[model samples]
Target: MSVVPRVANDSDPDISHVRDRGALRLIACGSVDDGKSTLIGRLLHEAQGVLDDQLAAITRESRRFGTTGEDVDFALLLDGLEAERQQGITIDVAYRFFSTARRAFVVADTPGHAQYTRNMATGASTSELAILLVDARKGLLEQTRRHAAIVALLGIRDVVLAVNKMDLVGWSPERFGEVTAAFRAFAGPLAFRSVIAIPLSARFGDNVAAASPSTPWYGGPTLLDHLETVADEIDIGRGEVLAPPRARPTVTRRFAADLVWMTDHDGLAGGRFLLKTGTTTVPAVITTIADRLDLGTLGRVPADRLGLNAIGRVHVETAVPVAIDSYAENRSTGAFILIDRTTHATAAAGLVIAWLDAARDVHAEASAVAPATRAFVKSQEPLVVWLTGLPGAGKSTIANLVEQRLVKLGHHTMLLDGDNVRQGLNADLGFDVASRAENVRRVAEVARLMTEAGLIVLVALVSPLRADRERAAGLFPPERFMEVLVEASPATCRTRDPKGLYAKAEAGRIANFTGRDQPYEPPLAPALVLPTDEIGPEIAAERLIQAILGRIRQPTASDDASI
Candidate 1:
């Protein structure tokens, strides 16, 4: 193997006649001070991607801000931000365009600081592969695990584990083996298609762009060669196949996605923003927050709202239809940014998981009979009375009484109690915030279907969060839906202990128990506040029936007399 000395102004072939190989997008990421910037700088410098004058300028800047004493600081080539130069750290994602004789590449040098994780996520959002760097001495760090997890979550299947600064570790093959084995073990569950570990000294340019004789035992392809060949494999593997016929951008109102919340403000349901992806932008609203990732276990938990640096699944609805694709298929068309409409700051970056009603070509078969016609035949307007409160708050009892009164009044009605639904429809759900939100969402949808059948639906649920209850109410027109808060203090509910839920929670047998470990937010301005502690269930039911009667088309005096 021959080694190429790191020299400036090495002449190379012109690219005008070279084949037009497509560009490969990749990101460099790891823990802070892991030599990510240096690795990228070396790759550019060795590939002759840096211009002569640009190199000279960094040489001068190196004197003022470089970490290396006398040697030229290659990291200065990518750390262009002033904050980065002063701190000797990368604060933002710096992208550089470089190419070898075989292929062109766009490389993003992402920050490794835990605080700047959101920036790393931004870079990963578009990258097809990841070059994760780790200091030869450190082996692996928490940030390394985090970056790897984010890469896997974002659909990056290819990884190049660059064990940088090999010289500091004496270029010991034993040490390299130890680090490689540890990484492979940790990354086993990340589902990486390939993880190629390469030991290199970015400062001395060993095993980066060319083969170095520093280690005769290391015989794998050099970094550049592997990247170019990887590109070839990606391109050629598909054969000369035509691109799939993309459907015209679906102009839809809503979509479900996985979002990495970047801002400090907590994101709740009903937050409005501008959804921008590719060239299409639309006014959008966060309709619901579903679940967030638990990085430690890599499992999902229910989320009421997304805090800073939180990765959660959410539902977004747009004011107008926009074109989008699944991120799994096309990264460019599938990723989007949500900008705060008020401040214009980016709130989150999201990957499209599924689009709701995005297929403009497919339509629901319209029913032969109209909902209004069905209601007219029933002699009553369809409605949904949503009752939300804490556990043991008498919601079920009142709902049952109201349903009985409605039936006696010669009106059709259906009652959906939360416990009853849990036994069947929501049997798989848990008591976490996300599960509760989904529980409410499913119940709300079912109530809507029932209302369309011309029956008044009564939903009795301990839908804890105000935002979730509001989302449920948003499903119906204001006149068609009534949000009734079953008011009761925690002490009162605990004393009642209708199902011994409070006892289980007090004994630490139940987690995320409403009014205990998890909080319950009552309706802000409910149509009716049934203080179950003050009024009996029958009286409360009567009050609810009277309030609902005002919203529906009641029988006239003459009609009642004939009956």
Candidate 2:
């Protein structure tokens, strides 16, 4: 089909006008039957982007497959496939270019089906704004919420809530208000900068490019006008732009990205693959499967492996360095694909979040007084006593007793229990591997700070992962950190079941339960082991107190006076 030239002449005044306003890349997405294709087609038609021949072709095809009787089906212009015309639904990402005297635009008409969500994501990854269409009659559907979530995830701050099919809804002001209000409320935490709700009828072309006389009570810019004037320029700082050497469009070896695993095969961590992004292709390894997106809730969950069609965050270490920016900044340089090394099959599609070695210019400020001075004044050496074991293993009970004993003996002590810490500082975290690691990291940092204050810190947690425990230990010197295992067999812990955790896990009520669904690797050589099954909490606490007291410096009369 023929097309209309965006500008009639090179010297046309509209050329400067379009350039001044800048081009806008946008995507139209929502649930099925939300009129996305029709809206885009009508926008192009009203903007004078469609040629007479193109209109005629669609008009002829509309007679054969149009939803509208005896009228040109605007959706036919974009529903190019035969199956789409027959089904009257979008199934692929259709990009159409259009221009107005005010601006130029490239709008992607993405599928609204749940199965084609990945296709919608592809379109959204490069868009500056999203026109989230919703059927005025249907209001907000699940797919509508899903698309909105994806739009926010991809970092499109501006959203146009196009409530289409207003004619069917009688252009009711109350209905429009309800849909708009529901969307704003649902999108509150999604972090959208703007949500402009435009009531329109895509099939009838009301409130699309021109203000519809049918909705005289409604006062808002036509969808086209809003699109023509929306500002998309972001203030990317000099350091934010230059700090990522890997973000450079050059080749890099290592980077971190958010990806959707597509293949049936599970992508295990440390597996070798081919990293293909932009113009570069290099051998790569997924060094870590950082986390997977729980799409149902849009939360990050810990994942060691990526399954079919799983959205995951991962770190890729390449054979060489690559030049790419965070996907939020530069879509062209940030998007990538992971291919199997042997089969050469595309395993996943990824968007760069950052380089593993992304540089930071900030420096840490040291205190005037040293930790040694604080310890000497307090007459006690700072130490972190980490107690790790399975649930119901008496770790918390033993830790509480030990801390109480130490306090009575005139020692400064801080006891950090798992449940208490989770309720406050780590409340936002989940039980996923990544969250657990973060949980351990936060506790370890806090423990380190407490040590600087010359206090004995007791951390009682079911730190299931040995790696996480070891990383926490790395924060302190050999003498300053002690790993204590509160040992109890799974059977013994279950019998105790103080919190009913084991029973819940056995009944499949809890997921990722350590010693049941998830693994718990005990410390190879703990400083002390209290077999809780063989000894009482009091006995265990006494043993722990003796061990801690032996390691710490004894208080002197001069040290006491200084404090």
Candidate 3:
């Protein structure tokens, strides 16, 4: 384990790689000088997992600068850097792939140095199980507590406390219990799924890959045995335990996340940054940093800002809403890092727990034009001229003529007829009541767009339902939405039907036919009521234009329920 390893596994399988089995992501992390490299290297070496070429290289490297002078430096297998070898400590995360007979494992060996805490956070972000190593002689260090807090903060419910170098402490079960109890008391509130303690001498291979007869009283599966069979562990973390797959969340988007501030710059409520959540990167800003948790004291205090290594629940706003699963459900996409746009530095890391407010973020995704631009362009107020009536009521004919007159007068306009729009924009919509309501909704949104472009949009629709019409009207400003009802008795419309729609509806070819099988609710407070049976389309068009001009040019007190 060198780098952060993502785990994927569904269920345990037989102790042979002959068949496809689940895999687990195990990350070895603890305080600096906690023997994280030796433990990982020891596990691989004892299992005879290294290739001959890799083993030859490690043997050569160990002779050059061995941690235990001329002795096998298992740490050399992971510490690839010359500086790391000279210092006898891991600097970078070592990522490697290894497998047992029954189950495969993706291991991450992370640095234990205090300055590299951010590195450790990266490693454990996607890990299903964390191996928090402790020096048997030294017991748990401050870094141990810090790593535990981070594991909990990242929402990894499964934990394993590896008491390394048990040989140094004379293999005292009492000492192991003492350290385990101390950590349990401190980590009880962190809400891990389970925390199992294991005693091992990584240097001597006590209980890492195989059991030791020296500790006969200790009766449990060895490290390798537990990896093969850990109950309740599944492939849900990454969904493919064979290899570390990129984290993908299903359906859910928008998140309330807990972040670990890693940059030197202090956080501000409105500062914008780029967020990296699995394969997706998006623009984001911190809405607020409510409190900072002191890892040493484990206390929450008021906070306006976060310095380096500060853990806080930051309210985040994204430019585009993303589909994400909860961190508890899928750790892959749920974890994220904040990047500084200017410097490309990692500013923070976060885990999403829930979805939150989206109105501001939605507005942020599109450009909002000032009313001056669109409304002032044509020297006329941009509006939706809603032409609502039953089938064959001359709504489209009058609406088309009104648009032609407005266009001829140098006023920009767009005519949206119900039949024409249904053929394209709403082709999937049926004549069901719900679909009809949605049809009106889509038309209203289009009209709103036209108004934003400073064009008078004449929407000729059956809009038979009063509630649907009202819903469409509410999308625009009261001064900008004018309702025109084209009235005619069903019998009179049937006789004068230009398209013969009433004939087809009457023949029972159309099922949910409005004004026949379905209901037609007339507008109660229309700006104008044009009786198409009494007046011709040309006269109706002229009257509709005059009614709209009065409202667009200068709405007067005399303009009441009828024009």
Candidate 4:
């Protein structure tokens, strides 16, 4: 092996022709018996990567395992595993490194069995281009569709539709065109960088390494020529191929994944599964299933659960925040495997696409007075009692009573109501969803600040969106934050409209009304649910105060308790 050092300005004019190119990683995959292993073995053999002794051994070995007598089974060079030889199939991803005079290549001959789809994904993560072969005699199969879906998920955009075994079908150009056109239509809007279709026979070595005269009708480059020119443009002056540069990869804390369930058990939402990404492993849950892929039609359909071999777009939440990147950005950081806890079996493989709510860039500043120290000084734990509901859901009525009860109990407390807040800090904001979310965010910030000062804060607002409310709850410790939902039907709220906002909204005098025009998303689960129609604010407020008092009871355990 010789290393060529780059020269910025050289005395020899030939130095200007050098435009640096990196090693290309490729994976060959498609339906089983589509000649994936044969194609790879042929490439390595043509490149002269195999040693003389190894070639002799394989030739003899091929005779024993070869289906065709003394034909030198090219698949034998790749299918070296004992099981693979017995089965006469590539069951694992067989990786090989070879170099042409002009380029270096790393090829992963992935298994085409549908059950081993995850293995194809494993190879595609580090690969940039895929050699997706279809048996010209057999056309496209379910395994071909499955491989395409998985390769797309793993972010391999450059594809080569190798219509292999053309000899078996008499090297028919019509068959090749038919398979190619069908694939293009099936993979419409896939947005891969390039899709080069080439007809070749791995068995006959036609178009595998060089252009073949057998296909006089075919006008495109051979399989090797296309693979070497992946960068698209050749610099005649420099004699180098320049691949398009990619944008910078971003670091994110969250992303949606296309999860492939591999185990027999069904994927359960909210179940704690161990997620392993790169070198980091953490507990995670499939928060929600967005949609699943229907392999038959290649269309997305609504689904809540994934069974064995099922694929779905899902939202995953880790127990702790993770520093991740999109699969398109960095495959190592974006690919992950979910493992079942009881069986300890690999359950599913996931590819991260978009990063949501990333916290990697957020840096927390240290405060001089810690919240614990402030609370200790005041002889009470800090708390944020958040009340959410419709406009006239008796939030303020219950809030006022709760404040009075806490005050009577000698607890220092303050009530921050929606109208009062709008009079000052949020006076400029309107009633839109964005403004409402910002409103809740600001309130949560203020409440967090107040709690840090050892004050019990009561927040009463018609914070409609559950997502906004969840954000507010995230601001404080789980035990210190309480979500109280004041339940009132739209009719009850309109009937008890002391502010008369509902009537005005119904009369077209107002816009963005919570119950009249805009909808409110009530909390699915809350610390307390106050049915104002059944009970008065006083009784509800009393129950809330008791809950708060019990929650704020700090542990009195001492380090010297054993003594």
Candidate 5:
């Protein structure tokens, strides 16, 4: 047995040449048994990319599993998984690589099943060209149309129609032409850049690598030949790359009549301008040039510093001037989305229009202290503690204790008990899945508002589902939302029976009660879990407080003594 030496990039000069030229990534897609896997395996084998040992292994595996008197099933080469071998279907997108003398190809053999359309989409999303296969005898099927539609939707510009199983149909030119015309008619209105059709029998390797004598009437280039010669298309709408840079101007406006403007080269140093009109984006260098100038018409400015939402025109002098527009002209194309430097999440959506003058007027009229001053006076950071557990699991008890401790510390605190809130705020909500989700959503919104108002909010709810908990978590800042799961066994909760709700569920009076009929998916990674079997309510409350504050390094002797 001989081994084909692995081709090394450093040793092969042609490999480097192709790398410089760039690789062609093609995704092969078709309905089941259109020979997608077989086509790819044959391409790999005929191109001498497959090693002898691997081929022998595939051959041995084929003989052991091949039905009755079947020839070497080349599909077996790519269908390596046990599940796929048993089912004889490709369940996922299988990637294979092979190269020819001119170019290297990365092939994605996508699954054809309707259920695996998402996987097909995954394969097609990055593909520059989609090789759509069809059985010559079958003509065109619904699945083929579906695959073509998805290819167009995912923005694949180039398409190669591989009409497989020509050998099964006796290499009929008329049959191939009929299928090709039908496909073209179906795909004519689609957004593909180009559609090239070829007739090939992947099983017998006809018209695949080299021109097959099987089709003398067909005069088109071979599949590989067409792939190697096709010109790489470019998107023309992307504007000129080497155009002379425009001079970006920074304008500064005063609350009075005078407006000062500067250019990138020599513009007025940092001043604020009310965006009068036009969509524009000035360079960040303007921030260095101006100090502070106020403009009229905008509403009360809230912050002392010019952060996001503080937009002003300042004079700037770049080496040149660039045409820019005000953010109000176009929101999507003109405005910029600002993200937090640390978290990378969108912190604020900014528009260039500014109302600095109006902001100063509003600030002059308002006599109340600012929110920052109020927060400072409170001497506590506002946060929301969400307690989730089964009913009768002592959530309310723990929440009450925790709130009392915070109250004693002179912190403004509010407890939104699940049962109490249901009476007033969530009165109209029901126990169905959608209703339950809505109820939790309303509570989370109210809690968020309370936290933002500089009040500590403790919510005690039997939020049985994990999805509901995650939704609540997303509404608040990461540092503000704390999830505390009150862990108690179903038997323990039933024995406690604080509300007799468990008894009602068992007696068939109530339906879909958590831990009785409906499921309670426990939190996978809660901030704190209080086990009622071991820790008393007092200790649990202290633990919850310590988790939230992080300043209480060691539990005081009095704290433990009280528990």
Candidate 6:
């Protein structure tokens, strides 16, 4: 494949227009089959970014898929990967780049399915605007509202609601007005600073690149026009910028006497100074130095002996008495966080609190654990058994059985069931993609803690989606994480109806419920696949135990194995 280089010509007015213009990173979000890909492809094709070879490829795919109409199947252009082409649904955020006469654009096409909302967040987190697509025929659906709410939460300031499929709806002005009004009413209170609504048909090229004659009643500019004009500036001063540095006291008597030098100019020549600690950047000076009184031997040395990465005690005079302890004291309150002034990204994690000599000794004594004794008496291994399946699949049952077998083997274990966690630890969480991700995040964190404490952790969650499972897997080492896919047909799960959730979802009591209203993306690959419909819980547990034992028996010398 040949790489396309970015070209700019000073003589060309279009190129010159964008010479110094800032880049805009935008996310396109909507329900499945809402023509997000087509709209983006239209924008790219009209802007002359789509190469002849790539356009030919898209045409070939379109013909193969039986889209014989003169208008190209623009969706084929973005469904580039083989898996995405076959699936007919975007499971991941597809990034595409294109430039206009006024500005450059980096577009993130995110999945509209509720199951992949987390993926949408990953795209929108860094976006300046969210282009939310609304199918003109379907109006504003549940997923549309969900995406809007997510865009607001991610701090995106600009939103463009492209009401697409106008050709299918005969480009009705009243329909466009109604849908646009409903969406604006729902999104008005969100964090977005501006919202622009446009009527367009991504497939028919209406209101995308050029003003569509079909929608003569519509007065606003096309989608591309809005994108080209939307301001790309962002305010990043909402959060704290810098954190305080950690401080520690010196144990040497000479350093104690150097306290005077902390504020005095004559005591030390090249000692390091910090303007602020934590949020307070108060100016301080070394004032007093007290010599070591307990030293049995007498020695004279300059205070310059304080070397690189060395800790020392010095009395400091500040413009004000800043409340700060040695970094060795408290890791949280004493810690300082650093942010990059340019990109606004967190650059470094810092510790601010420090401890004095006597306090350091006491802290060391209190916090130190007898590792050798603990290892000898009750050494334990930590592992996470991640169970994933459809909603009513028998994950919890198998998890219970596995816990019993591990307990019988004299291993410390804990079960983190989805329902139990939803009631307690993840009570504040919802069923949306963001909430689901947060739920999994909490579970993964708890599992990590349990593993560190030398306990086996079993997580019985429907998990449903592969991205969530992958995020959980990333939290632990490969050897420590066992992804067990409890396979059962969606039909079987609805039939099982262990908790009547499926019934409630089918009755419309719940909106965007997985397996009914939302999609359940299965695990692409898993360490184990237990046929929940075919096997009993006991047999499943036995199989899992055997697999665990086999893994343990493998020639791995240590548990902290890196993958």
Reference-based lDDT, residue 360, model 6: 30
Q: Which wins on lDDT, candidate 4 or candidate 6?
A: 4
Give the best candidate by lDDT. Answer: 1
Cα lDDT tens digits for candidate 2, 80-171: 98889888898888877788887788788999887677678767866789999999999988788878877776778999999999999888
Range of the 10 consecutive residues with the lowest summed lDDT in candidate 2: 2-11
Kindly list the per-residue Cα lDDT of model 1 for residues 1-563, writing each as its tens digit. 21111101101122112224566878999999989998899999999988999999988988999888888899999998888899999999888778888778878899999889889997887577899999999988888988888888788899999988889988999999999998898888888998999999888889998887887889888888889887332321211122334433344557889898888899998676777765455667787899998766667899889998788899987644455657676554567889997799889988888877636466346877777767777889899999988998899999999998899999999999998999999999998665776788789889988988889999999888766666667667789999999888899999999899999999999999988898777776899999988998999999999999999985343443223
Q: Per-residue lDDT tens digits of candidate 3, residues 258-359?
A: 888777788877566777665456666675677888776778888888887778877775544455556777665467788997899888888776776443
Higher lDDT: candidate 3 or 5? Answer: 3
Residue 260 Cα positional deviation in candidate 1, in Å, after optimal superposition: 9.9
Minimum summed lDDT over a 10-residue window in model 6 is located at 253-262
After TM-score superposition, what is the CA distance of residue 118 in candidate 3 from its true location, in Å?
A: 1.9
Q: Model 5 off-target regions past 4 Å?
A: 1-21, 41-94, 98-104, 110-122, 140-157, 181-194, 203-206, 209-221, 229-377, 420-429, 445-454, 474-481, 487-511, 524-563
RMSD of each: 11.4, 15.4, 20.0, 12.4, 19.6, 24.2
Sequence-dependent TM-score of model 4: 0.62
lDDT tens readout by residue for model 5, 434-535: 556667777987887776566889999988877567767866677778888999999999999988998898899998788978788789898889998788
TM-score of every model versus the real structure: 0.60, 0.56, 0.60, 0.62, 0.57, 0.42
Worst 10 residues of 3 by lDDT: 7-16
Q: What is the C-alpha lDDT of each candidate?
A: 0.81, 0.80, 0.76, 0.77, 0.64, 0.64
Per-residue CA lDDT of candidate 4, range 395-473, in tens?
9998998888888877778899999999999998888665776687778889988998888999999988776677677
- Model 4 pairs in collision: 17-238
Better of 3 and 5 by TM-score: 3
Provide the global lDDT of candidate 4 against the true structure. Answer: 0.77
